[model samples]
Target chain A: MTEQPTEGEPIRTGIVGLGKMGISHFAIVNAHPDLELVAVADTNSFLTSAIKRYTKVEVYKDFKRMINEAKLDAVLIATPTRFHFEVARYALERGINVFVEKPFTLTLEEGRALVDLAKQKGVVNQVGFHNHFVGTFAEVRRLVNAQAIGEVYHVTGEAYGQVVTKPKTSTWRSKKSEGGGCLHDYASHVVDLMNWVVGPPVKVLGAHLNSIFSEGVDDAVHAVFEYKNGMSGQLTTNWSDTTYRKMTTRISINGKKGKIIADRQEVRVFLMPGCEVDGYGEGWSIKYITDLQKPVWFYMRGEEYSTQIDTFAHNIKSRNTEGENTFASAYATDEVLDMIQKADRARS
Target chain B: MDRILFGDNQFFGVNHMSEEKARAQSMKFKDTAAIMKVIDVAYSEGIKTFMCTTHDRIGEVTDIVRDNPDRYNNFTFYPGMPYAHKYANAVGELGIMGTLKKFAPGSIISTVIRGAMAGITQDAYELMKMLVDAEMQRFQGTRTPVVFLQNVVTDLLLGFNMREMFRAFHDYVQQKYEAEAGFFSMNMPMLVDVLHGEGIENPIVCSNINKIGFRMCGGIEKYIDTLKTKQFRPIAMSVYASGAIPPEEAIKWVCELPKLEAIVFGASSRRNIVGTRDLVEKYWRFDN
Candidate 1:
């Protein structure tokens, strides 16, 4: 479609980490009004087409070019998992805002650097863990707030089918040295979800195994966590299974009355733990979705590249953005993953 | 003397990323080097007949600015650019690293006509108009009329389905542009010579798949019909196509033709030149 300006307008944006994701992100900038995909600086030739197609935009096969020529309002980073820190730091140093893809920064320490930089620059920033807004998750939030499932007891999150089918050859996706593999690639979502519902984890003890995409990155992982509220949970993510494979987590809680299972589509609860569930002991009954979030569920892949880039376009009109996708959400997610990696999976 | 000349047909091998690589590799310089290498070598060999001008425009636009000349230096410069004087003079005068400041923009136009592709947008047309004006105003009307050593100029005038395989005309130009430009620039060449019965500079030319229906035109002689159709003329040249005809046999037949000037032969290595030169001396059927 044609998005024309009233003339003499500048839509400044910066993109980092030139990869497939970054290229697609450039498409996001391309199709947005009030958005000029100004400078694309990646360590590789990832955004060459992006730069040319959006003519008059500056490009850097290196980060320094983004810093130098493009006076950007915001920067989106999709770099090597490790390079995320340095590139984000550089953009922040330039006072450019940021939109980073997940695994926010490499380490918590690096994450802190970005947080500090964002604060110091006084610019708005967000991370792309856009899936939180899709599917029954939004409904999951509504149901919980409405107390549709009662008290939170035990949350079981399962993420599968990440590494069971290997991509041909190797990409940045297959390296632990670069935050590669499934635990970081897919389970980073689960960590975000856990935080979204349970606030934060008090302690996380996890064990991981590598089944495929064996560049020493974890593809299979099991984790159990204790929240500060004396509540506990068990969650597992596997990249080695397919067929019935997908991203699904059943968060069931037994409050004073019954229990509920909130997945991507619908939230189901046995009102008395006796009627619907086959193995429910006594007070089990089926309670249909009392409330559902109004978004069209984006199954399989996030709806047309997820996060319905429209909100982001409208976000351009606002001064602040808040959600599971806010920079706070990203930093929080990174903190959890880094903690889990260090405590549960980092060991050789 | 039969006015014949040599032209490389498979010059810059077309370089659009095949669908196979869509998933495996991101299109990048390292990936596109195969086509780039050929262009670099094509110029070093002094075979100036170029069918794609956008490729040359790219070299002159961005590469040299970054202190990257080794890549663009292998070929003689011939491109059909929009504005040669402004682009060349600006890039050349900018004296910035990674920019194309040294190449002569005027020489660009004399290399190709309307790129290897056609369909000029208003912006492109404007770019051409400004190019001619800027070239004349800046260099004092000293701009060289540029045209790529192209295929049937007359067939293009005749409309669709006239030239076999020429349907890929736009694509051929894009291939040259990508290969020569190191694969990023997209601007196409402008056709400024059709109705005026005009010719591009450096009359060296080549005929590719569009060689049928034109009489006495042996193996690939059909393209000559377009030139005849355009009320056009060319310095006749024979090229090495398909199997081995030996350089001597190829040159002899061209020399026997009414206006054949020189027959171009491709070489894989330095040793191949010896056989080509031997054939030229022993069997060249020149008027001399």
Candidate 2:
């Protein structure tokens, strides 16, 4: 692993891409007691100029120059999915810890290369599968591990949002070449959570990618997955649903003796007469996120965002590479994405 | 600050406990009249201080309140600024510069010049003032005694260690709007410390303060200590912990906290509104 920073000195950090996510990360990173945000790079001049004018941190139009000049101990890459591989690769080659936003890379090959390079450099590497940090989802993982829902036989992962009810113009998110689609922009979260709670699927049984609003990309994705042990699951995601005010992800696990349904806000579990789990009733038990979540030092839209960043910071400090949502784990999710795509193609 | 303020989260489909309930609430309050109906109920119950975000829909509510001054007599609004979704949507529709030009609080040319000047002088405080003015536009022709910075921006600024922005907001609101600046944060203990460090004594701050400590960043003990000792006006939100705690216990617990200046809760029905008002009146004595 890279040499740990001095005992008292904050970890030098830089962030690339000042989009919505990037700006949020900037605030969190800057506020972190153990992180010193030295510089930021974004192509948007207005954002860069605003940062330069408002704060003392440096700004740059080129991320490469920022990495070279800032001498960052870690870098957070929130660029479009197409740029994740390039930005993360550059940082990893220089022995800098990297935290890339979700949908790790555009292709499985690119994700594999980064995973290997991160291992070679012995640097901390993580992907932004933020659901892994959500308390309810994390609780779901714990319950599944403890067999609270005994021997999960099936699962259903679903996500819905009002991202594009009516297609007006195309942004990077609506363009397929830029890795904007239901699969990458939305469903990957549910898929990653599924992979985490239930083991990764060994095969894709069927898949359908539909373009309801966008011409170049799928607005909704549906697929079935089959595990090697004969367990099966499905993914249902849509970004064009007007019913949702924001993106909501839910996972339901069906076991032989019980069932568990969970979202960001709460987890619901139902057990048969003999199926017993600690702190849960035999008939039904409900746990709200407030009960499950630990307080974060800072909270923005949600606690998961800040918690993920804090976990990354702790991993870097402790020189631990095998934390949650590592590049390796994210690559496994990427491989699942590839399987679904190939399944859809074969069906067509 | 009013001792019992009614929030607008329920009308805006922001149920922290369940997505299904939030969706149902969204569908139920799809019309402006539907939202006003609940506000009228809360108003009738003497909870006249409506702590609301400056959502576009709230602008409509403001218009109704402005028109019917006799009905809403003594009505006060505690407006929270930088309704983040509005800005996010604006950025999506109009690019960043376009959004700046659209919401820059004045004529396009003058705003452009002022923006450039702010950039050159390195005075983001001026831009912040302008944006505050822009958000406060809808609350015009009404009484806004306390204007709050939303927790999203408040906590973000707190994270950035930007103490001056807090001071700037406090000073700007006091001077221009003739109002006390309120801050909403998830981390109450940290924010109270930061505001005190900025020399803002007896500051008005709102956060989640409930029996279970749901969303209380520094935990219940630290919050209790802050409430017991800090020299600031504390307004408790999420008192029910998003429906996890029963109303009786929740109201009783928070009402007993030391130095609690106000409690804000949101409900959609007249029965729930009256019920909550009764609970507060039963436990906490409010002096006129």
Candidate 3:
């Protein structure tokens, strides 16, 4: 294992895969002063050479070779969902910190393996569930923890879009073997949010998985989840809804004291009779994330992505075991997805 | 295909409008005999075709129909496959791969190997084909002239742009099972357009066709336009709009449509069956 970097020294970072998300991470890693962009690996030499022109970083077509010889402090594997397990395992087994993208792995078995490996290696690990870092979502979580919504009873997460209204057979997203469809692509975020706010679902009550826009994979996932704390919820995500312009995720949490509805732009809270939250009396309170967010250097749309990367960088420096976006927590969402995919009715 | 097909929603307690009524129907039709009595009423009224899902209870009905050749010699079943619940229930009983192995036809050894290699090396199309073969197993030796692709799978295929599977299912039924393929979808207008685009001429489509467009997707105007122009067989269902439309108005509006070839409805009593039959007989007439 490499020795921990002393104060004022940047953490060496390498990235694999130069896809859209991969490129986004590359920009973030390159821009961050605390993290040094060391190397990148992808099959496309054009992409590799393009990055080489801008920075004096090593580029390789082979990710394994980059991991073996790069002498990196951490690696961000931004490949598809199917490759997350193998890539993360390779990095984690060598005592390198990891920041893999969402859905963790396609299945629970693989996700659990990564979580175990990260724990065994004693390295900082985080899954790219950027929604968790959103201001409104964080605020909602804070209020819920403060008993703003007392005794949570149920939750519902709806994510809809018109991305795949037609057939999409060209990419990995269309194939079930490659962790394709809405359940893995979009619902993964919603599932993670549900687990974060309400708690991990103990059971899946009913599921209606449809490949309404894609073959072999599900384009829509509508499932009912029963949480451990006597709470029940439903998750509905359709990636082929022509009615929606772009993808949007909206979550509603209903507790005994009140209800909170959170979307991208804002959070709306409605207090009930038994409300006990301080500073705010019952009726309704609206908080827009736009008003609360601070400006970042590389601001594309939201700072959540940058915030997560910064958190991962700090964790690596401090030798923190893991953060809120741990592989273990992400594995819970994978388990719920597995349960919903495999069951027709409620499963305990 | 029969002009009037009887549905099994009442037998299965699928009343969309009233949960209490659905619960009562579920309690009443808890036994196969109760379901049989309703089917008998429809049959007695000359409703010979039964367009039904491949639910477990329907297996009993199929057995009864097979046993009584004299009474139900002309009864035809338009079996809908991939009964979404069946796979889920099976998975709950067995593990996901175990359920796949169990439902996949052929010897246990080959089935296990196929199930094991399903998502890895093998294509999901083979798995879907196997699922169809498994669901169609119970209706063997019976009159299943038109095999249906349920809306759960139908609309999914539409959304995915996997038109090849539609053609595959159509070809599979025609070549292997010697049956015409039919599609049941919530969105009739879109389904018709998609089926036609796939070179499927005059595809038989069953969808929600009511006076008020209860669940008729793609809007009522598009449906009317498609009905007026498309060269396909249309089967109107949910004519009563789950008790929203008056019986006479619902049946009359649907039966008078330009390209409607059949209407499927569910009723528990002889009186309702007779009423439906008389309404169809009165409104559906030849122009020439």
TM-score of chain B of each: 0.38, 0.92, 0.91
Superposed model 3: Cα runs more than 4 Å off = A273-276, A344-348, B1-288
For model 1 chain A, give the 10-residue run with minimal summed lDDT.
A293-302
Candidate with the greatest lDDT versus the true structure? 2
Which candidate, 2 or 3, has the higher TM-score? 2
Every candidate's lDDT: 0.47, 0.88, 0.78
Candidate 2 CAPRI level:
medium
Give the per-residue lDDT digits (tens) of candidate 3, residues A1-348. 556666789998999877656766876787677999899998755446545543577899888999999988899998878888888999888889999988889877788889888899888889999988887788788888888988889899989866566664455667778777788888999999988887888888789888785778788989988878678999999978855434577889998889999876667899976565665568897766544344343332246777788889989878897676999888888898888887743432
Q: Which candidate leads in TM-score?
A: 2
Question: Would you estimate the TM-scores of all the predictions?
Answer: 0.49, 0.94, 0.54
Kindly give the stretch of ten consecutive residues in candidate 2 chain B with the minimal lDDT sum: B113-122
**Alpha carbon lDDT of residue A79, candidate 3?**
82
| 2 against 3, candidate with superior DockQ | 2
Interface RMSD measured for model 1: 23.3
Off by over 4 Å in 2: B89-126, B197-199, B285-288
- Residue A240 lDDT in candidate 2: 85
- Candidate 1, A1-348: lDDT as tens digits: 112122346447777765645655665465455667667775433124324432555667777776667666667888767788887777778766667888787778888877877766665667777656654466556555666545677676667552435533255666677877667777787777767765777777665555554646766777777777677766677765643223444455555456665554445555544332332335433222212323211111233243444455445445444423666667787776766776764554
| CAPRI-style class, candidate 3 | incorrect
Question: lDDT value for candidate 3?
Answer: 0.78
